[model samples]
Target: MQDCFQRTDWEVFDHQDLENHTSVVLDYIRFCTDNVTRDRCIRIYPNRKPWMTEEVQSLLTARNTGFRSGDKVLYSAAKANLKRGIREAKVAYRRKIEDPHQE
Candidate 1:
């Protein structure tokens, strides 16, 4: 990274105005950083429910699969189970938050 910065011809932006020069410099820095850094897959769910757990996620997937299978009975059962699981998870999370020393 340091070598990249040293080798870059910053004089190329000297002819540009202040705003354009700043933008170009920032873009160059970002390009160099991106080339030198390892890419990573970071999952960020900003709107995800705080009480969501792996069990609840699995139940949700099952419900979606049942719905897609065109089986009304199966979908209904899966939906019910998902709802129950979500409720239980929420209650458990609440209890845990309210009584941190319990478990």
Candidate 2:
């Protein structure tokens, strides 16, 4: 973007400046990337699988909570629910692939 370019400190070039300019630019970029603007300019998105719906995610979260709480009954139930959700997702994916008009 124009803002990105405008923020850069442009260096003046002299008669024998081409090679020096390349090295200086490379070093500056390395410095900025390593220590200055590392992840500040990055946008992180949640990793979502194609078959993972909200229902599946919620079930998985419940399972994790149950495990963390050390409740065998809740953990078992949530694990079963997660398995069922995955099975349903696989069936839905296959049905979609087979019949495209199922949605």
Candidate 3:
């Protein structure tokens, strides 16, 4: 939890709320979402406060310094690996469910 809080780059959220919201979105996205709707969803808004908070995302345009290129590359690789692992796991899970002898 301490490590997660220290990682400011990621959106820290409650596990239950995040999981529920994401499941809802993913279920809906399978059918309803299109390019325009996706764009609208990506544009984050805060109801109680201003959207342009300095501690988070602001209206300030970012200049690409290319300083974090290595970090970005590593993150991309990690994400790809994670996705592959998830897909393989899901496939194995479905196979086991279909044929319990393989379980």
lDDT per residue as tens, model 1, 42-87: 4758998878999999999999999999999999999999999999
lDDT of 3 by residue, 1-103 (tens): 3443354343322346877768765654443434223332345455633222342221121212222454676556555555555566567657765885553
Write candidate 2's Cα lDDT for 1-103 as tens digits: 3454567767442326688878877776675566534243534358866677788989999999999999999999999999999999888878876985456
Task: Report backbone clashes per prediction.
Answer: 0, 0, 0
TM-score winner, 1 or 2: 1
Better-scoring candidate (TM-score), 1 or 3: 1
User: Which candidate number maximizes lDDT?
Assistant: 1
For model 1, how many clashes?
0
Task: State how far residue 90 of model 1 sits from its true place (Å).
Answer: 0.7
Report the Cα RMSD per candidate: 11.7, 12.0, 23.3
Higher-scoring candidate on TM-score, 2 or 3 = 2
Location of the lowest summed lDDT over 10 successive residues in candidate 3: 56-65
Error of 1 at 33 (Å): 42
* TM of each candidate vs. truth: 0.55, 0.52, 0.32
TM-score of 3: 0.32
Clashing pairs for model 3 are none
| Model 1 TM-score relative to the real fold | 0.55
